[model samples]
Target: MRIRRVVLLMAVGAALAGCGADGEPIQPTMSANVGVGTSGTYGGVGVGLRRGGLGVYLGL
Candidate 1:
């Protein structure tokens, strides 16, 4: 009886695992980026917000 219970539990766990999201996980909602040139004359900063496949970014 105990062995049958164990086998049943294992099968359930496997089925649940297979039902997980099919692709890469969603990214975070907020992010920042900064860049500078070697000559010290070029630099910029950016802020962004993302949701699913949509996002917005602002840079200077």
Candidate 2:
């Protein structure tokens, strides 16, 4: 009985090990935006990740 309990607890802990803050896993993403002026056009591109209710971006 004690061995069963220990095995059950180990299984539960292994299952919970995969759990984490609710949100998508960190992943690479890209975005772009553009605008036009009377005489010219402008645009920007960025790459970053969106994870755990936060976003990071790098652009040029």
Estimate the TM-score of every prediction: 0.36, 0.44
Best model per lDDT: 2
**What tens digits encode model 2's per-residue C-alpha lDDT throughout 1-60?**
655654565454444433433545555565678999998998765555555676665564
What is the C-alpha local distance difference test score of each model? 0.46, 0.58
- Predicted structure 1, TM vs. truth: 0.36
Q: What ranges in model 2 sit over 4 Å off?
A: 1-24
Residue pairs whose backbone atoms clash in candidate 1: none
Best by TM-score: 2
lDDT of 1 at 37: 73
The CA lDDT at 38 in model 2 is 100
Lowest-lDDT window of 10 residues in candidate 1?
23-32
Q: Report the lDDT tens digits of candidate 1 across residue range 6-45.
A: 4565455445445434854333232335556786554333
